[model samples]
Target: NMIEDSEEDTHERYEVEILSKENRRIPAEMVVESIECRGEPGKLVIIRDLTREKQAEKELKDTQTFFEKIIDAIAEPVMVIENDFRVKLLNNAARELLPGNSETPFLCYKISHGRDTPCEGKEHPCPLVEVRNSGKPEVVEHVHQTNGKERYVEIVASPFFDSDGNFVGIIESMRDITERKHAEEAIKKYAKELEEVNRLKDTFLDIMHHDLLNPLGTAMGYLDLLMDTEDQEIKSELEVVNRNISRAIDLIESATRLSKLQSKNSLELEDINLREIVDRCIENFSYEASKAGMKIENRITQPISVKANKIIEEVFSNLISNAIKYASEGTKVIIEAEEKENSLRIKVKDFGKGIKDSSKQEIFERFRRKEKRSIKGSGLGLAIASRIVELHSGKIWVEDNPEGGAVFVVEIPKK
Candidate 1:
């Protein structure tokens, strides 16, 4: 065939297979030229083996196919886009996202966005264009409309380079984040509703404080005058009434305080002496402790300054009062402090009934108290203490004392 083609065209080249000694087919390239050698008309032929070249070509194709299959197996849509906004290569997921009728050298913007030009804007910024311009990777969020349904997609565009380290284009991995976006929007809406609900609750509490507490105060004043009449039975009856009125007042005041503390986001902090605060709380509760046949052991005598506000005193006061109220008669309530690397750990331990493991966590929530009915409380005290400690970036928890009691621990930042 090469000799016949050389006779017509004077020169020809053919790629053909020839049989080897072992009868195996071998690929070869042959060149045939019509020539006059030694004054005779003949064809000059030259043959070159092509088995290695063919093998190399097949290996390259197989490598490309292997990587293409790996890319297609990925869940997220992947595309290799050229600098001209053309889709050079794509995976199966990308093919599903792109147009089915898209031809070779597909324009990415046209196939993906149904647009004639590249995407450009603050909201729908083009990550491909950014990568091309900056020669760096970029991540961007895009809202795509397909079949009249909006889809949120996060595109991670990375710079693609050839084997020679020359910049080629960008490889983009597109992840569908529509569900996550919807969830975030729902959370924001729920948060707004909760904020409004809290505002209404605060308003209602304020109204109750004004309308209920003022009249109760006036009634107490009348009772005080009535008790001065010097009638024994009447005086005892008024004393009971006075005690009930004071309890009602305390409940109302505690609720108001807890409400205010819950509504606050931050506090004005200062350098306060923890030892002084604890001592003052002990002094304030000393008479009550003595009346209950208990003594408060203050082990925090040394000057220890902590970053907190005046309200921190309320934490210690509540703990000590609670200890005296619950501890056995003649038992000592110990107030101790241990300085930490970045904070202080203060423990108010009482030789009383310890908190149950089941109710230990529940006790910190508002209106959730685990105590006997004889223990008169508004159930807002511990909740208020928890909120104040939270405001100071502190933590409070209860533990069982080694000597058969409860130990309330509070940790607060030193600085």
Candidate 2:
């Protein structure tokens, strides 16, 4: 339709052509020409109103452009591969992703996997085959080598059908996940390093354990020589030295066993006399108790035999040390063992400020302490004791002493 110069100058509305029989005027194109109809000369006129058709064509073109823009806008590589594994379409990203072969319909295997033939299930999965077989979407992850470097990609592929509802091809989208792959590898590396550090720590501990006791044994051997002297003053000093060395030995043994317990290593079990174990613990802790103005009272004189290991003795040693350390001056620390139906209960009670009601269970965890108790300790003593007891199928707990202190108890199976 063309506007006339006269129509533009008028203030009134311009002419609106009618379409078919409708009264409402719309845009139309009409052509009149001379023609011969049935041997008679007549002018034939044809008119076509193109407003709806033009709008529909514009809308369709805009929709097609929008979809094309969307496909090109994605950063991930995308392609449409037919059932024969030939690439039907590829986006700008995919074209740039694959370095060459822009003008050719390349095989998907050649572009992705650099293979001359299509992917077979024996070596690599073929998404086209799988999607056709299942008539559904499929996903796969692959590591490809390009430019002397490896890259991991996650491929999401879906089946595409023609307008006739027949399978035509598969739409495959690829996302680069090489960064995530590196992160997983880093985690595995760190785990291996941590394991190595733990092994070295264990080795260091073993060396320290052995090296420390060797010199202490030598010192004790020499002390025995001095212990045979007749002079009372020299003998008395040697006795003190012997007592301190013995306590040091007990501490080293405790440390060794505690470290081993952290690894959950198996302990050597043997028949042990509970009475002798208690007596030995009291003897080892006598110096510390005396320094705190406390005395240990052993109430278990009868021999009580049980199936336990050498580490079991450390349990009583730790409990006795705690009692003596926490109890007040001039207080008595009592130790007793009672035979039960299927177990033996060892009780160590101290007459001093008792443990808090809430801390009975918390005291057994690593590095936990009551805010009110100011005694200096590594805090692993009770934890180690609890672990050793558990290994022996035993239970260890603390209760409020009837005499204004705490009573620690350990119950172990007699077998």
| Per-model lDDT | 0.87, 0.81
> Which candidate ranks first by TM-score, i.e. highest?
1
Report the C-alpha lDDT of model 2 over 32-104, residue by residue, as the tens digit: 5556689885555566776887689899999988887888898898898987888887888887666447665
Candidate 1: minimum summed lDDT over ten consecutive residues — where?
1-10
Counting clashing residue pairs in each candidate, in order, gives: 0, 0
- Residue 58 C-alpha lDDT in model 2: 92
Best by lDDT: 1
The 10-residue segment with the lowest total lDDT in model 2: 3-12
* lDDT score of residue 61 within candidate 1: 100
Q: Write the per-residue lDDT of candidate 1 for residues 1-415, one digit (tens) a residue.
A: 5576557337778999999999999999999888877977888889999999999999999999999999999999998888778788888887776543456677887887788788999987888878878889899998777667888989999998889987788999999899999999999999999999988998889888998899999999999899998789999889888888887888899999998897799999999988999988999988988888898998877899888999999998988988887665528899899889999999999988788999999988888876755566777789999999999999999999988889999999987
**Candidate 2 total steric clashes:** 0
- CA shift at 122, candidate 1, in angstroms? 2.6
Cand. 2 TM to true fold = 0.53
